[model samples]
Target: MIMQKGKVKIAAVGLGNRTCKYLRYVEEHGESAELVAVVDPDPSKADWAREAFSLSSEHCFRSFDELAASGLQLDACIIGTPDLYHHELAVAAMRSGWHVLLEKPMGQTEEQCRDIVEVSAETGRIVTVCYILRYHPYFMKLNELSSDPRMGKILSIKHIERVGKDRTAHTFVRGPWNMKEMNTTVFFTKCCHDVDFVLWLTGGQVESVKSEKGTRIFTSADAPAGAADRCVRCAVEQGCPYSAVDLYLRRKDWIKGFVAQPGESQEDMILRMLDESRYGRCVYCCPENDVIDRQSVVMEMADGVKAEVVMECVTDEKDRYTVIECENAVITGDESSIEVTYKDSSVPQEKYDFQWTRGMEFHAGADHQVVKEFIDSIASGELQTRTPSSEALASHLICFRAEK
Candidate 1:
């Protein structure tokens, strides 16, 4: 498709917070990219698309079918819908002759992921998976050090993703993703990024994985006595760390998902959302939450480099930490910075640090970089996407195996 104004014309299939962050790239780099259309079932998101882009009602569609029927000429489509919808939306967009930039956890199952790969090949439409760590500065540094000649042959890697208490409660325990059927399991939903990071850093696929994982604390057996069904009315909610009253009402955090209704006050809207929606449910009382709360995996890569990955929702803070041990030196990093220490004695620099900057700090600027590169590739008429569905399948299969 020939884009107008020399910019890559793109339509966004989902207008949630994740897609909204990606759309920021289009707004900031207007000369190279354009958001020609948007689709979402939520009225609040439609209102956002209209105001954010000065879009006419015709340009803001309620579904991908509507957007496709609108006949807007587009070079690409961004699929950031829920996990359950990824395979469907991606296949539809690609079959419609538009290349796709699909969000992570490409599909809910191994069969679905393979089908997406097959369809992308059959249609010859580019499919770029959103593994943000591949673009993040911090993880990029880890990849650099893993391959640095001075660091010597790689040995092993230990990576941890701290999903944290508040986020786990909001997204996994009581949110739309609480049940397996609504979205995928927490492993695929969250740890796909972690697993993919290791695969990228190692530059090899896994031979086998020895893993142990489960929902540790968010079960009925762990609930306290006299706990109310919802946190709004629970007497025990006062001292609870995962209190919805504390996170939503008093601090007003994690409310980004629920926007205020057209004429409703913010306070009244939040109150109504808490009482009427799943967000207000007590964390311990959620028996229907089938997604895991903790996971640990030891992956043996094809090159004999072993990587251990740990994902947990019990941490006080949310971040990723990695340690890569090589023959001559040891490298370590949290999301903020990296450090390398040498084994040689009397070296001029026994140890040093590494840090990265950001144009937009969201996802440590990975979101911005992912969108920027995808748009550039499309605008340049590049046949191969940077993160292809074939490459992403290696990492996805590991998470899918967790079900067995």
Candidate 2:
């Protein structure tokens, strides 16, 4: 499928709703790439691709293996399958001499991640793991600030990622990545990008991680007796908060409404969000609901810097927060003083905010930037690639360790 034009022939392996993110990238930057093929087990999605993206009928594949054996001479393949299927699909793509753009977390475990890395090495093919944060301009600014000498040696860091209760029920308790056991670990699945960002920003490895998780709220008991499986049929649909059908309707912020919010809600918003969206179904009432609703972790970077992070599936909605502490700073009794003494009692405090700055022409999100850079690098043979697979693998190892 090689052509004289600027297009790089590529195949997309998944067509879930999330694929919209990648599709937007292609539509906006189609000159650099072409939808050479579309692969998905779902016939509807494949048909949608043909009609929506002008993909030829011959280009839609029923499975990754079918596409791999198609001899289409593809330049690359993007693997957007569910978390559990990432490693195998990526390996198959790389082994077949097609460059791969794997979604975050890389793989489920360190061993599987290593296997992918080994395969990439053996094939001499590029494997770019998508850790969108690396390409985020806001984080890029943070990195610049950290690099400054006046910042004076970052000694500690704190980060928190909170989601409302409505969100928890939709993604964890009901979504495909819901189960915590095998499909995806919360830390690896949800926070791998952040872990990678920490490593990238600090330029250090995670020496150790101590994490704790629990299902603090959103239980099946909340559902009516025998109202199992489908929440739509349950008589409690109108009364119970967090009803799936209701959540969907209220997800206007997701579909058309402006203030830009995820369909999921934090713990505080659970009750209020109940029956606000379609996700409120008593899905958790079934035996398959196993994802963690709350989690916290503390880690020691290889540089001896200690960092604490908490990701709670809360009932309230708040933006992500990151604060860095510099141990080298001294509080001159007048700079916002809170009287301090000497010895170990003089634990000084100074805060630097790393909150993301809003407004950008193409904040297609960090993941899109990562994909763009990877493809650009591959086409131009630029030696520099942001969020390379090996570095992403290290972050995955830290996450895998945390999950364990």
Evaluated with TM-score, which candidate comes out highest? 1
- Clashes in predicted model 2: 38
Off by over 4 Å in 2: 1-6, 222-241, 252-280, 328-365
**Tens-digit lDDT track for model 2 on 277-356?**
33444764646666677777788987888777677775566345566665543211111121212224455543433233
- Candidate 1 residue-wise lDDT, 88-139, digit = tens: 9999999888889999889888888999999999998889999988887767
Over all chains combined, what TM-score does candidate 1 have?
Answer: 0.94
The root-mean-square deviation over C-alpha atoms between each candidate and the true structure, in angstroms, is 2.3, 7.1
Each model's lDDT comes to 0.85, 0.67
User: Candidate 2: lDDT of 168?
Assistant: 64
Worst 10 residues of 2 by lDDT: 331-340
Model 1: CA > 4 A from native: 1-5, 348-360
Error of 1 at 265 (Å): 2.5
